[model samples]
Target: MTDSIVRVAGLTKKFGAFTAIDDVSFTVERNKIYGLLGRNGAGKTTLMQLLTGQQFATSGTLEVFGASPVENARVLQSLCFIKESQKYPDSFRPDHVLASAPWFFAHWDAAFAARLVDDFRLPLNRPIKKLSRGQLSAVGVIVELASRAPLTFFDEPYLGLDAVARQIFYDRLLEDYAEHPRTIILSTHLIDEVSNLLEHVLVIDEGRILIDQDAEQLRGSASTVVGKKTDVDAFVAGRDIISRTGIGGLASVTVAGLSAAERAAARATGLELSPVSLQQLIVQRTTSDTAESETVTTTDAWSARS
Candidate 1:
């Protein structure tokens, strides 16, 4: 079994009367990429902060590298957290940020950092405060990738990046990770884009863990069944239905925990079956009731076009 790099039990973080992270518990394994997924205000950032020692949990135990990360130099040294809204000194230039990175990360690679600077076309001499949003994001990506820390947390690192730049980041990350394996937790809203790169997924909704499982297993855990309304309803009866839509005499319902045999049986009954994308499944699971109702209306409209 892979070693657990980070562990939490009954972790909770609250601000006044509001609970940002409510009694969360999970283990992050070594040498795997984990996707920290959630909608806005879902406490994904708060959880990252707790794990990285930037914030103290209100209750429960938290451990990183087998010790409390709070003020622990050894545990802090193994961490590299890059945030979407990262801030740097007003007087600092891009080159200054790159130059100072070595002090924090013992495994920092100057050569790799320089290569990434060139790759992103970042102006090293330009003052960071004057750089555009995309350029600022590139700087963070460069540091996190070149740091090569044992445990890296990238919280929506591609906020202002364009399609090409985001692809570059993903490609470089995959390439480097293959050569130097480590634990990486990427928190992002771009679920489908990075779904293939994730080994494990942890979803947060309303300050709670809604889903935690292997990425491959999650993909196969839910399926969409479509056919005559009566037949589809029968197949989905008593099953865990995530969402459903229908138009005229036809219907489509996404159901969870349908085994391979169950899927084959649906096909045998002349019902069409399709796989649900990771993004679709997560959205359905985490969206609010009002948003889900809106989705159902939208789905019905789309089904009418078919």
Candidate 2:
């Protein structure tokens, strides 16, 4: 891996006596896109706040480009944080935000921002407070993309964007990323939407790392097999099953790993196999511990075996 653009060791964040981020340590390599995933209240935001120096770490160290980022102008100037509810001064208009970008971003692209405004159909004259949620989100997208920060943190950048605008944002982001690769940390609940764009995923559940792996490896690590209930059970009897479900004589089993031998064996049993997607994996990993997950038990998921 290239030198880490972001490094956190024993990073901790406390709110009064409650600890939000608990000694989280990780390295984000330069020029890579990382998916920061978790459900609500998973400390994903806290981690981002620390990395971007929005808030101080209670304990441990945080380094962006090999130096303490807290109050460090050199580091802060190269970073852009797109927040969920990006606030603006009351009555401030979209044009005002654009006018101020040059002061904050060293390489601010005025032409790109103007194009985005046109594409997003933002009314430059309208006050930020008067704009709809979707328009507000579009404003942040414009700034973040046009700013071209070396380390960009997109925290739920599409909070209220509709499908069409969201697609536009994704398309533009990918196009720009290809031409100008940088370290990006995207935190969002819309896992399935950006699953393909994520090179790596770090999943935190209730403030703990639930899953961390390359997207490709994660895709291959599990598979769902369906067939006669008995045949399916027999085929999965000795293998590691992540989850399963069944109705009557038909059964669907999600298992880990499928070697050539296993695939051949499953085919002989007339079992249908399909790859488990990243979204499915995240769902299985995060929701299994809940009491309601028992409803999924009769379907015969091997997640318990994990």
lDDT of 2 by residue, 1-306 (tens): 678888878888899988888877788888888999987889998888888888998999899988988999999998999677777889799999999988999878898888888888999999999999989989998999999899988988888888788888889889889998888888986787888889989898766677778888888888999999999998999888788789999999899989878899899889999888777777777774553465345223433321
State candidate 2's TM-score: 0.92
Across 96-120, the per-residue lDDT of candidate 1 in tens digits comes to 9999999999999999999888889
What shift in Å separates residue 256 of candidate 1 from its native position after superposition? 0.9
Tell me the TM-score of each prediction against the true structure: 0.94, 0.92
Which of the numbered candidates is closest to the native, going by highest lDDT? Answer: 1
Misplaced by over 4 Å in model 2 are 291-306
lDDT of 2 at 169: 88
As a whole number from 0 to 100, the lDDT of residue 14 in candidate 1 is 96
Which structure among the candidates has the greatest TM-score? Answer: 1
